[model samples]
Structure formats: C-alpha cells, structure tokens
Target: MKLLSTPTRRIVAISFFCMLAFQATYFVGVIGCATYTLGADAAGVSALVFLLNVVLVAGNLASGPLIDSAGPRRTLLAVCAATSVLGLAVWLAPVSYPGLVAAAMALGFSFGMSTTAIDAYPRYFSEDAGELARMNSLNQVATGASVVVGPALAGWVTTWAPVQCVFAILALAPLPAVALVWATREELTAARGEGAGCGAGAPGAGGEAPTQDAVPGLFVEGDATPAPDGRAGVRGFLSDAAEGVRLVFGRSELRVLFFIGFLGFFVYGAFDSLESLFYRDVLRVGADWMGWLSAASGVGVVVGSLLVLRIPKQRLSTRLLAAILALVGVGSMIYTGTPIVAVAAVGQVICGIGFGALAPVRTTLTQQRCEPGNVGRVSSVMRMGMNSAGTLPLLVSPALAAAFGPQAVLFGASTLAALIGLAFALRGDE
Candidate 1:
C-alpha cells in the first residue's frame, strides 16, 4: 500500500541518503582519525568530540532563522554543498591534526544545519498527526540505516586503506542530495506556503493559541508576526533565536519533551569519550569490532523503527516514550556490563532498539505540539537542548572513565539513565 505521497516519498528519500552520507563521513573520519592520526589518544579524541559538538551548538542556533527565513529547501542545498566541499578539501589536503580539527568543525556546523532542515521537512509537507508520525518514523529509519552502514564501513575501510581515501569517498556522497533537493524546488515552495497557515493558532489547526508571554512581541496577540528580514543583522537573528527558545520553554508540554530528550542525550555523552576504549580495553577487541557492534545496534534500531510503524497511532504516548528510555538504559548496561565481544554486540542491539524507537516519538510529539510556522525554530531549540546536554557531560566523563575503568563508568551512567526513565514512567507525566 502506498503510505506517503510521491512528493513526500521523494523528500524522505533525499533526506535519508543525504543524512547517510553526512553520518558516514562523520563516523569514518572520527574513527579513522582517532585510530590513525591521533594515535588512539583518549584525551585527544575527547577534545575533537567536544569541539565538534560546540560548533554543532552554534550551527543549531543559526539554522532555525535560516530555515524560517530562507526555507528548508534553500538551507538544505547550501549545507549539502558546503559539506561536499569540506569533504573534498579534507580529501585533497595534508592529513594534519589541525586540518582534521578544522574539517570536523565545518562538518559539525553543516550537520547541525542539515539536521534542523530535515526535521522541519515533515511539518512543511503535511499537518496530519498520523502522516507526521510516519514521516518521523521513516526519518529515524534513515538514521538507523546510516548508523548501521557508516561505522561498519569506516571500520572495514580503516582495516586496509589509508584514512584519506574515506574523505575522498565522502566528497562524492552528498552530490546526489544536492541534485535531488534542487529538483524539488517548486514543490517545497508550495508546501511551505500551505504549512504557514496550519500553525497551532490558525483557525482550524485545533490547538489553543500560545500565551502572549510565550514569545512576547514576536507572536503579538494571536498572530505570528513574520520574523524580521534575514538581512536585518545580528540583532534580528538573535531576536528570532530567542523567540524560538521562549516558544519551546513557554509551553509545559514542549518543556517536558525538551527535558526528556536532554536527559537521554546527556547519558550518551560518556560514550563519546569511552566507547572505543571499551572495545579495546574491556571487550579486548580491535577497533574493527566497534564498527561491527555499532552496526548490530543499528540493526536493532531498524527493528524498533519498524515496530513503531506497527503501533496504533494512539499508543504513541509519553508513557511509551518513557518505557523506551528505560529500555535504552537497560540495553546500555548490558552493552557495557560484559567483557565478551559477543555479549556486547547483543547489548548494542538492545540499546539500539530503544534509541531507534525514541527518535520518532519525541519528534512527532514536538511537531504535533508546536506551531507550524515556528516548527523550524522550535525543532532547532529542541536540537540545541539535546546537543548541549550531550556536550556538557564530556567535560567530566573522561576523568570518570580514568578513575574507574571505562566499563564501570559506562555502567554507572547507564544505571542512572535507567533509574530516571523508570521514575518518569511510573510517575506517568503527560
């Protein structure tokens, strides 16, 4: 049966592959660079991850206005082109630590922009809750597929070829997306027009209007005033960004969603510092195993995404979200609690399922609850919350990992996440 319309399918396909390309480059570059260029130094790897996330936070802050002003089509085209160029530069240039760091920053920013654009696409294409849920599920499928292939591909490639070649291949990956997005220009423009009138406060949109204090002067009375012109300078941009932040926190539902997402990612921060080392030190395996285990997790994510599709739309509730969060934490504990490679892979899959299921639920809730006109900005605020949460724990994770072995540190974090998820689930917060 045809689930999504032709245009929607095309858009989903483009987003899927584009995100795959970007994620592949990221995984390959980070793993290859860490293993080969940085000589497997944990501290150096931590620094790279920290810097990349810092730039990503900046990119998320800027992308909301770009999406709201220029539209997702334009934003996608620009970021994809920039990513391809950055990849080409890294491929051709000398492989110095400094060069890699610069490339990582560029990639991080482009990634942040592209992610916000992609997330906002569903809001533009349709307003139906079921359709939005389907779109988000498909998007999460793309993420899962990328997670499966990218790291595994990285691991396999690093086993034989020079790390430089991976970047060369990455240079070609986003080119297809550029062409695809350009072809959809007219469709996207029309969709954007339709979406603007479907905001929560619109006559038939079926939601209470946001409070005056939600965005102060920006959404004066019940109308969403157009943001100041894009060329209106930094003050205008900051105003737009601040509006997005306020819009998210002003609503009780959005605020709760943001907190849930933040907690999930905050728990993930430790993995940046300790995951690879877990493979080497705990699993007592080569770096290649990390890719394979990650792929296993990706497979689990695929399963989880499929499960979401089968769920009754009504069942996709906050309680389900809480359950999935707890599931993920349990999986993480299983993943890190064991020293055996086979056992770790099992844990990865279990953990992957929770993550896979979690994305669509959170995204669908955010999309459904927010005003359509401000979807892009709202999504960016959500992204910023998660990214910042993910980034902050990095500051202390390495120290924790060092003091207590990587496995123990990871285990403790997982336990904490599980406890939090369970608490929330039992409380049944709406």
Candidate 2:
C-alpha cells in the first residue's frame, strides 16, 4: 500500500527513529541509573542533563552552517551514525562516573545535531507552506508517539533484561535512520544545488532572487560566489555564526519568534524537570499513574497534530500561534492550580495538544520567513534560542521548586507564557 509518499515515508521514518532514540536515551540516562541502582542519583542526574544541554546549544550553533555547507541529508546521516555509535558505547562501557559522562557528551552532541539537521531535511521534498506544515505535523506526530512509548519501552526492558540490553536496543534505533538517509543521497545532492535548476536568472524556491537586504545571516543564500579556498576555516565559522546571530536579532519578526520559542522551551524544561517531584510529592501518583500522566501530553500532541490537516491552509497565521500559545498557558495554569492528580492530568493533555498544534505552525512560519538558502542557519538559531532557554531553567527548576514550591514556579511559567502570547497577538506583524 502506497498510503504515504516516498519523501513522506522517508521523513517520517527518520523522524520516528530519531525521536525514539532520543527519548529512549534520555529516560534511560535519567531513570535507568536510579531504578537499577547503577550509581547516578538525583544530584548526578543534573550533571548529565546539564552536559546534554550545553552540548545541544553548541551543536545547534555549529549545525546551521554545517547543514548549509554539507547539505541536510549528509548531516542527518552523520548524526544518526554518531548517535547509534554513542548508544552502543553507553551500553558497552562500564557504568562508571567517567563512562557515563563521556556517553553524555557524545549522546548530547549527536542528538543536538540530529535535531538541527532533521528540521532542514523536509525542504528537500517540498517548499510549499501547506506541504511543509503537513510534513512538520507528521514529524511532530512521530515525536509524540515516541514520547508516549519510549519511556514505557525502556522501563519494560530495564525490568526484564539488563540495562545494557536496553541501551543496545536503543542504539539500533538510529541504524534505520542512517540507512533511510543514505538512500536519499541523490535527492540531497539535487537540493544542495537548487539554484542551478532555476536556470541563470529564475527566482528561487523563496519566490524571488535571494538578496542581501531583509536578510543578514551567517551565510548569504543566493550568492553564486564560491567560498574562498573552498572551505570556511575556524575563523570563518565563528564569523558566520556571529552574522547569523545578527541577522536573527536585526529582524523584528525573527526576534519575536525567537522570544516566543525561548519562553516555550523554558516553560517546558522547567515543568519537565519538576515533573516527577510534582507527581510524587504533590499528587501522590504511583509509578504506573506517572507513566499515564506523562503519556497524556503525548496523546494530546497526536490528537492536536491531526487537526492541522483539517484547518484551512490559509487560516494558519500569526493569530493561530497566539491561540495555541494562550491555550498552552491556560493548560499549564490549570495543571498547576490543583493538587488533584486527575486535574493535573487533564492540564497535561491540554498543554500537549496546544504545543503540538504550535509546532507545525512555528516551523512553517520560520521556513516561510527565512530565505531558502539560509533556512538551515535560521532554524539553527531558533533551536539555539529554545535550547539555551531550557538549560538555565532546567538547572534552576529543582531549586526553585524547593524554595517557591512546584505549583508556584509552574504558575509563574504559565503566566510568562500567557504574557508572551498576548504580546504576539496584540502586536500583530510589524
């Protein structure tokens, strides 16, 4: 059955594998060590997550130019291979402090690069906004599905088999992504030289010749001029990165989106970091109920993503984003307002759906606004904002919760989200 198109199948399969691998590694790293008494604890756990966040931010910064220079497919394949190798290493190495730290570094860098590259891969298939939205929604669905299943699967494997076996299985998940990406090498080559196909003077996929005006990024999109010496050295890389940062800040629209993304990830990171505490201490949820509570958001993500297909394509606008943001804020507030476990669960579901719907819309807008040539770089910048926002919050969330209480911190996060969403809604496109 040809229910899915070739490109769609490839993108979905790769996205699924990446999400599954990421979730498995993350949960295993956090929960596996403690559940099995392998040495890492609540304190040590923070170190691992902190290491991952640091590497993720660095990777996002480096990945933008790398994707533009190396092309998205190649970058995707490389990251997948690296992730698989790291997963295996995590399993094979002695579960010691040093070993786990090394695994964290490798895994974090690989996962970071994987995410940055995957967002750009869809461009190889379609440039249309609707098509991109649908594709992004599918990718979000993959992530939601994996989030629902990955932890459960990891727990089951850790219970029945040894932790090593669980790691080994997670390692294999990226192998399929590697193969799928390698198969599309030809497509990647074509996409890399997209300008050539438009002929000498025809417009690019962005609907006009890429110009230096209205854009100032690490790499100029339509410059036919080849790189000096055919390679950007370390200095060049840094310079390009600086320019990309400038471009993002110079544009008002990009700046607003970046701020919203930061707030989104900041809230998510804070909530996720305090999730176990809230459920265990406040709601008194058991391990079984905890899993269900966690999966509720994932279920909502799937349900909300499906709604994208039904929405009138033209109606997906800045206003849609505002609505989604407000919904997420409201959901989070409701979730944190009560000590009742069931009510919190409902809040999680609502928040998940809102975030899920926003994912595709945000991606579409980012892709639409940025020139095709620099989409990867712009996306990486966006990731940088989101990733960076999460890092500090994650580190502080536990301590903050201890002082202010989980409910209070969570309520503040919701208020922040609501205010940001309101700004976007009221400001309109400048």
Candidate 3:
C-alpha cells in the first residue's frame, strides 16, 4: 500500500515476526512453561505476573524517551537482542523461584520496549491521517496473525517437545527481525529528520497551507516546535515526554480515550493472566486447545480490523468508543461466564473483534488529534496507562481467585468491565 514506503513496510514485516515470536514465547515459552515447571497455583502465578507487570510498567515509562532519543532502529535492535537473550536465560537458568522471577523481569522489560518502539516507529513514515490509519490497521493485521498462530504453535511445541525447547526456539526467532531492522537503520534515521519538516515546511496539495489540525505526519502548525536536528539528548527526551503527557491530559478526547483504554486493557490483562489456569482447572481444556481458543480471538480481531475499512469516515467521538466498549463488555461476559469451551471460544472471538476495531480507531484518533511533535509521547502515555492499569489486576487477581474462586473472580471482573463499557456507551458523545 502507498501508505507504507519500502522501509516502513520492512518495519511492519519485522514487527509481525517479532510479535509472532513474542506471543509464542510469552504465552507458551514463558507463562505456560512456568506453569508447568512451577505449578499453576494462584500464589505462584500471581507473584510471577506481578513481577512481570512491575518491570513492564517501568519499561513503558522509559520507552518513549528511549525511542525519541535512541531512534526506532536502535531501540528495535536493543529490544530484540535483549529479548532473545532473556528467552535463552529463561531456558538455561535454574528453574527455581528466584531464577524464574528474574527471567520474567528481563522478558517483561524487553517486551515493553518492543511494543513502544513498534507503535511509534510507523509515525515517521505516514504522510497523512488516512495513511496513518491504514498503516496502523495493517500493523494490527500482522499482530493479529501472530496472535492467531503463536499460541497454537507454542502450545503444540511445548506440549510435545521439552518445555525448554520452546524457549530455545524463541531465542532464535528474533535474529531475523534484528537483522532486517538493522538493514533499514540508515533509512529509518533519515526519516526521523525528514519527519521534522513534515508539517512545518510542507503546504498541503494545491498550495494551501495546512491547518493546525489538518496536516499529516508528526509536526503540525502550532504544535510544539519539532525536535532539534540530530539525536535527542537525555534532557530533550524528558522535556518531550513531559510535554507529551501534558498534551494527552490537556485534551478532553485524549483523556477520555485513555481512561476507557485503561479499563479495557485491565480486563484483558486479568483475563489473559488467568486464562490458562481457568481453562485447566475449571474447563478441563488442555494446552493445545487453549492455544486454539486464543487463535479464535485472533481471527476475530483480524476480521474486525478489516471491517473498519467499510465504515464511513466521520469525526471520532465518545459514542463510537462507547459502542465498541459495550460490545467488548458483552463478549467478555460470554467468555467468562461459559464453562463450555466452544461457547467461551465464541466469546473470545467477539471480544477480539471489538478490540480489533477499537485499536486502530483509537490509535488513528490519537494521531490525528496530536501535534506532530508530541505523537510519540502521547501514544506512549496512553499505552503506559493501559499497561499500568494492568498491574493491579496482576497482583490482586490471584488473591481474588483464591478467595472467591477463579470463575467467580473472572465473571465479576468481566461484568464490571461490561457495565463500564455500556455505561460509557449510554453517555452521549461530549
């Protein structure tokens, strides 16, 4: 697609491979492996999840400045390399409690960095709002592809092969992605400079000056002055990141979306963190089927993203987000309430579809509303909110499950999430 230049396309492809590896490693290689090795009791799982999220939250906070200062190529390379090493560490390290926790933290940081870099990297290449949406949607497709397959592959491999072998495979998965990203370093860095002049120097087609909000790419008229030429220093990163947070909270729409996004991802993190255990203990499903169920959601997400193309263009508003949130809520209830695997799978697909549509819309809306200079920071901040929100659930869900039963805990959380979405949906767009 014209929305993506060759280098950007390469970046997206690398993102896909990296996501595939990550999904595979995380779901099966890390979580599943840990469950098998450590036993899937609530306390152990909860502690592991809490540790991972703590590190992940830290990574999310730092990723924005790191990307801005270090550049995406360098960030990608560092994240990918670190991830591969961690995967190996998880494999080779003694599987004692401390050893597993240490491995989880390292993996969490790498994964956190990877997500921020991927989300921010594409902004440099998109020329307009439409192109940005298309790029993000396509990126969703790549991620969805991984979501569809990663679990199934991981489950199968871990089930059949030695659990350690899954991590070994994951260790090698990112080498190619690292190599591909390295090849594009010059182009990627050059785009960073090219991005500086995006809205600042270019008039819209037909020689009309772009409006403060109308121009595409990162910097629009009246936006924060574009970053200085060449690499950003530590002080510049802090300034840019702080400005980004201010911009996000300063806007009503951005603020609202971040709030809703946080709720959505909180439910997601809780659900995912407990899903394997729930299915194992409550539903009697095995690892392979667990993977398949996840793939069902992946399919739904891909379909939902594609479906967005058919929706007519209009200004994004709270109404649209509310509706999608409501849809997700309903789906969550179905998935969490059901004991039947098939029924739960159906629910998973429904939730996935809602999220699939919501992801691109939210991302594009954020981009459109953001001043170019603040794009990376704003995006990172919202993401950080979601990631941070998940931390509480990671720490507390196991305790809740222990007291109330996992099924009750999940159902209650899903119900709250659904109500939150529905309530927001009922509220008229501001």
The prediction achieving the highest TM-score against the true structure is 3
**lDDT for each candidate structure:** 0.76, 0.71, 0.75
Q: Could you tell me which 10 consecutive residues in candidate 3 have the lowest summed lDDT?
A: 203-212
Off by over 4 Å in 1: 1-9, 64-75, 119-140, 188-260, 309-320, 361-385, 423-430
Which structure is stronger by lDDT: 1 or 3? 1
lDDT of 3 by residue, 1-430 (tens): 4644476577778778788877776666556656666666766777777888788767877898888777777999988888788777777766677776787787778778888888877776656678777767677667878898887777677567765566775687789789878776643345445443444444433344433444345533324544465466667888878987888888887887887888888888787578768877777765666667778888888888888777776846677876787788788888878789888989989999998888777777778777887788999998888877777687788778888887888888888878887787787665
> What's the CA RMSD of model 2 in angstroms?
7.1
lDDT per residue for candidate 1 within 1-430, as digits (tens), equals 1543365675677676676666666655765567555666566667778988889868878998888777778899888888888888888888877887888788888888888888886665555678878977677666667778877776676677766666755677788778777765533455334334557754467965444343322222344544467566667778889999999899877887888788788877878767877776777766556567878888998888778888887887777788888998999999999898887888899998988788779899889888799999999999888878888877887778778877898999899889888887887756
User: lDDT tens string, model 2, 1-430?
Assistant: 2633487777888888888887766655444443343544334555667786788667877898898778778899878887888788777767776676677677778777888888877766665678878878788668778887766666566555665556675589999888888766535355335443465433554355544332222123565444566456657778877877887889987777777777877888776555655655677644344445656777877777778768887777776777688888888888887899889889989998888788778778788778887787788888878877777776776677768876788889898897788778887764
Q: How big is the positional error of residue 96 in model 1, measured in Å on the Cα after superposition?
A: 2.8
- In candidate 3, how many clashes are counted? 2
lDDT, model 3, position 24: 77
RMSD of each: 7.6, 7.1, 7.2
User: Considering TM-score, where higher is better, how would the candidates rank from best to worst?
Assistant: 3, 1, 2
Model 2 lDDT, full chain set: 0.71
What TM-score does model 3 achieve against the real structure? Answer: 0.76
